[model samples]
Target: MRHYVAGGTEHGGGIGRLIGYILTAQPQSAHDQLVTDTRGARWSKLRSPPLLWAAMAVMVKDRLLAPDRVHHLHIAGRGSTARKVILGGLARGLGCTHVLHLHDFDYASDFLRRPPWQRRAIRALFRGADRVIVLGERDRSTASDLLGVPARSISVLHNAVPDPRQSGNATLDPPAPDAPARIVFLGQLGPRKGVPELLNALSHPAMASLNWTAVVAGDGPVDHYRAEAAQLGLSDRVTLPGWLDRAQTRALSESSDILALPSHAEGMAMAVLEGLAHGLAVVTTRVGAHEEILHDEETCRFVPVGDVEALARALADLVAHPETRAQLAMAGRDQYRNALSIEAYIGKLDAMHRSVSRGALRGASAQRGTV
Candidate 1:
């Protein structure tokens, strides 16, 4: 069967990387084709409405013309605009079964805040999908409640990372007592990532005596965060390494004692998954798939969103107790193996594809009075 995957291809965002993984994992028989929706250069702003429409139009036309196509379209993005365009317009008009994979944590809140007409439009787009793939239990509940879709129709698939244990670079040993604990944050350095708050947390009085260093690694306004770090007198302890490649990120993660990301929102952070894969003690806010995947003080430490004092205390506690960090790191790796491996992710996706394909065929046969 032929599968059409439509989403950002060139953008350096998580969704684009997700599409890359899906493409790489496809079996030979699937003959999957990727339809580029947005380019990386245009990622900072919304693509012109006419341009997006034209792109979707071309994708729909190509799918319609393909021979022996199963018409399994998987669209990944954050907002309802792309969903409305593809599922509501192209997929509906072409009678194609589609999967709506949501990657944003604030989708429910944003959906509720929209005008009535727009809200209805968004709901209609979600309801039209053959299957809705959400990142966690919370997102599934939100989709069911706000979009009026059944919970069974929504699959809670957490993002996965390759097992770092197999890489032979994972640091399983306890941290050296003489060395300061290293905490690494990997993602865009923006307000949404709570970089400012993280700086504030590091500057708190509780963390004054903590022997630790933090590396903020990712692109976006590095100068701004640098200024904040300097103002907090953290210039010596905090390192802004700009953007690191995959190998670099993996190396940093492997060497680090803690992976801290206090994001305001997320669907399922790949960085967090990568951190867990590398067996680093994770300290993050209770957002996105975190609530479903992480156990407080067990697999990782969870703090309230935007709480600087609590974050500082958590960091201090982890740094002062290396044994605790080691325990949490090992537990986080175990959790990754049990629940968030790449094999597990692909298996669930394949099952969903099979189910959707079967239902589509059944519907077609019934329409022809042959079933």
Candidate 2:
């Protein structure tokens, strides 16, 4: 068996990193080959230009049709501009099984806003694939509507994370109970992340009732966000830690009581998953992927997007009710283990590949009028 997995790199705390790691863990032997095309991933973008070009060439070569060899093709996160063109042509040329993984909802949004010539080309690229994999039902429905694909063509695969277990590094201690309850935001800090509102919300009546310290652990448009926090007199309350490695971020999650992110837009938040993995309850908005996983008063508490008062109230609820925090944490940990395990994810991927392969064989036989 051969498996080809391709996707984005971990940029601070993106879901792509987790996906890449999960794919790499798949069983590989001397006979079974695994090829990864990370040409347009975050790591490749930082490498020398010549090496990047070479990697792209290699990816294109690997993606080409191989007669009699069952190919499991995955296009995810970022690929070259010619990636879809090459892969689609390969599928048509060789009729190999193809899988298109949609990480962001931007593709369909672009197809709608762009001119007809561009939209037609984009549509054709998506139409050529045998299957499309998405993180949740929301993205699946949106992609289907814009691309004119049937629900059957799309598979809703929940983003998988490692079974959340405590990294028993004795030196790493949970935050002191006497210290302010830690509130962490773990993503690129930009306008889109709702940093300004988070800052403003810190000064709200409900938030003022509790003692909390904020840790912002990502880099992007930092100057503006820092300035806003200072202007709101939240400089002391918020810590702009710039960026943290995975281990460091995990430590923060284990130590934190509340994972606060009032994102204006998100497909799904891997950080929220990470928070759950570490047994930290979440406080996020209702839109995007949050609605898919979280139930208010169940896994975590939620408020409407952009409502600072509501966000503050939710935060206060967690702070004042320590038992609630403990309960949510336990529930979130269970959710991650039961539904988003690496074992479950790999099983799903394997099923998709086999189903597509079998369907392809059946179609070829039918076209030849073989009963």
- Which one wins on lDDT? 1
Regions of candidate 2 where Cα sits further than 4 Å from its true position = 1-15, 24-56, 63-86, 105-107, 166-176, 364-371
Task: Give model 2's TM-score versus the native structure.
Answer: 0.84
lDDT at residue 22 of model 1 (Cα atoms): 59
Clash-forming residue pairs, model 2: none
In the range 258-334, model 1's lDDT, one tens digit per residue, is 89899998888988888888888999988887878889989999988899999999998999898888899889989
Q: Give the Å error, residue 75, model 2.
A: 6.3
Cα RMSD (Å) between model 2 and the true structure? 3.7
Model 2 clash tally, residue pairs: 0
Cα lDDT of all candidates, in order? 0.76, 0.68
Q: What is the lDDT of residue 340 in candidate 1?
A: 88
User: Model 2 over residues 156-221: C-alpha lDDT tens digits?
Assistant: 877766653633552334556667788899888875676777777777778876878888778777
TM-score of decoy 1: 0.88
